[model samples]
Target: MTKDLYARHRSVLPDWLALYYEDPLEITHGEGRHVWDSAGNKYLDFFGGILTTMTAHALPEVTKAVSEQAGRIIHSSTLYLNRPMVELAERIAHVSGIPDARVFFTTSGTEANDTALLLATAHRRSNTILAMRNSYHGRSFSSVGITGNRGWSPTSLSPLQTLYVHGGVRTRGPYAHLDDRDFIDACVADLLDLLGHTRPPAALIAEPVQGVGGFTSPPDGLYAAFREVLHERGILWIADEVQTGWGRTGDHFWGWQAHGRSGPPDIVTFAKGIGNGMSVGGVIARAEIMNCLDANSISTFGGTQVTMAAGLANLNHLLEHDLQGNARRVGGLLIERLRAVAAQVPHVREVRGRGLMIGVELTRPGTDEAAPEVASAVLEEARAGGLLVGKGGGHSTSVLRIAPPMSLTVAEAEEGAAILERALRSI
Candidate 1:
């Protein structure tokens, strides 16, 4: 059935679409932190739809709003304003700590990012966009041009001006001992120098904790310092919180907030968790930048009625249930457990990330060459054990990307970690 479905869609879908990563499992439905395949096989979704669906799947409130809105109206296009869209925009701006920040919605994370790039380029009226090496923005031409990873940059990459720099925080000594203030300072210094010298960039796009690019968490002072430099140079600081937004980091409402920013980004883009599996994304910018988008800006399917309802409900549930608090508590427990497991397993290179957005990088038996094959083996083994994980990073390193729903339970976290430990032992 899966093969037939793929075959039927192959003709219309672009040949470049990488559908092979998905196995033959026909996912029927999902709830909370688990999903079931067509054959009634249950799999714990540690991947959380690649870090989206933070609150969980088929959430009661979100589903109710989606279904109700679907009956009333599914879409009216950007030409007309809908209540759900309006309310969602208001709520997003409110939580973002940027009052009256205008929003431009899109149908997906890639679309949101693509729109952000266009807005930044046009607003700044400059050519250069600075991005971190090994970062995964989106596949759209403008975004792919700025994405530093070569893996995603094929012939389709846009011929636009851009600069790339090393991203992610580096750690030394022992996994048992974190809080390496000195190392953090050095990383900050190097980054500041790079950005300072490469001034005049239209915008510096970054992820709070480098997602796909190994889930690297930069030094504590990196983002704020970088923002200061950008402000001094009049460069826009674009925070691509597509993967890290919506309280997944636990301590804050958005990953940028986790960076200790008093105010949010000059422009902030989000997608995944806003709709909790439905297609929706948005860019929230300061009024200063928004005023610049007076005309000649639009998105065809931005924040459709149904999607906006879903996003609004998801955000509401997140706030009411204090999912951010859960994320912090559960995420801390999960991180500690992962570090414990890594200590036992020599193959585990580093366990890095914040909140529930975690990645476990694996090295060779004794080398720096990212053992992607080993990572693949671990992933396959975990799947066979009924746990679904995700992959990321430059060489697609052995980073078991475990971004389960923020509703993930302590018991689920332990079970998932155990399964992962078993998979690592086998690998």
Candidate 2:
């Protein structure tokens, strides 16, 4: 049945849409951190649907909210004063840390980033943008313009002139060998040099942890240094926290907090994890920047009652249960466990990331070259051993992405890590 479904999927879907594993899976149902395939096989889900399922599968709170909202009224758009929408907006604004923050909701992260771009471009009256090398924003035309990752970006044509900057990747760039202070200084100098050559830009968009680019991040104070330079020139700093937000990084409530040395970012774009599995993405910005556009705008499917309810429930659950602390504890153990095993594996070049959002990059045994084939083998092997992990990289390298729900138990983490260890060994 899965084979037949795969055949139909290929016939109808675009060729570029990728599926994982040698044989694709049809997931029938999931609960907690585990899922079942069409063949009734069980698997411990480590990827959490590409980091979207922030809480857990079949979370009762979120499920009850969705069901109750659906039973009441779910179709009310932004035209009406939706209670759930406003409440969720208030909650997000309080947590967003942007001064006088205002929230705008969308259906996906791409649209959220698109809105951020529009705001920055309009507020600054310039189309030139600065983005970190190997950064991934989203798939929309405007978002792809700012994305520096070649693998995720499909087109060069863009509405904005996006200049790729340095310091997103910490281990493989020209300044990789430098210590933390020197690395930050080098990247700041590079950014200054870039600014001197180009016209005034609207914004510098970056991911605190490069999600699709192998979970690479700069030194702690790198963005803070960049912030000072950008602030002097009136350029907005957009923190794309799509994959790193909602306590996934463990130590901080938001990934931008790690770089909060200067101040909170001018604008923050978020998606994926906020609603757990529900489609909820939004942008938060100060009043001046958010109100730049005079024309009335609304997202048709954005901020619907159902999605907002789901978001509210998910956020409440996350905060009430202190899942961030859980991620910090469990993720710490998991990463250390992974590092211990990775030390023995010749193919592992690096094990990096914060909290639950972690990456294990595989290279050739004795060479620095990326071993994508080996990564693929590991993925299949992991699936065979009843574990599900994801893969990502900016430049065709294979980085095993391990981001389970924030509520992952210590026992589950141990089990998943053991399964992953076996997979890496097999490869």
- Highest TM-score, which number? 2
List ranges where model 2 is wrong by over 4 Å: none
lDDT of 2 by residue, 275-303 (tens): 88899999999999999998998888999
Return the clash pairs for model 2, or none.
none
Root mean square deviation (Cα) for candidate 2:
0.7
lDDT over C-alpha atoms for residue 311 of model 2: 95
What TM-score, over all chains together, does every model reach? 0.92, 0.99
Q: Write the per-residue lDDT of candidate 1 for residues 1-427, one digit (tens) a residue.
A: 7778777778688887664144645679998899998778899999877777778888999889988998988888888767888898888888787666888889888888877777787788887888876678887777888877677777444756787754354542222134546554554566567766754678888888778777877666567766776787788888899988888888777777855553568889999887888899888888777767566655678878998988899888888998888988999999999899889887888887778989898887666667888888898888888899887776655577889999999999999988998999897
Shift in Å, residue 423, candidate 2: 0.7
How high is the lDDT of residue 83 in model 2? 94
Scored against the true structure, residue 241 in model 1 reaches a CA lDDT of 91
Error of 1 at 306 (Å): 0.5
Best by lDDT: 2
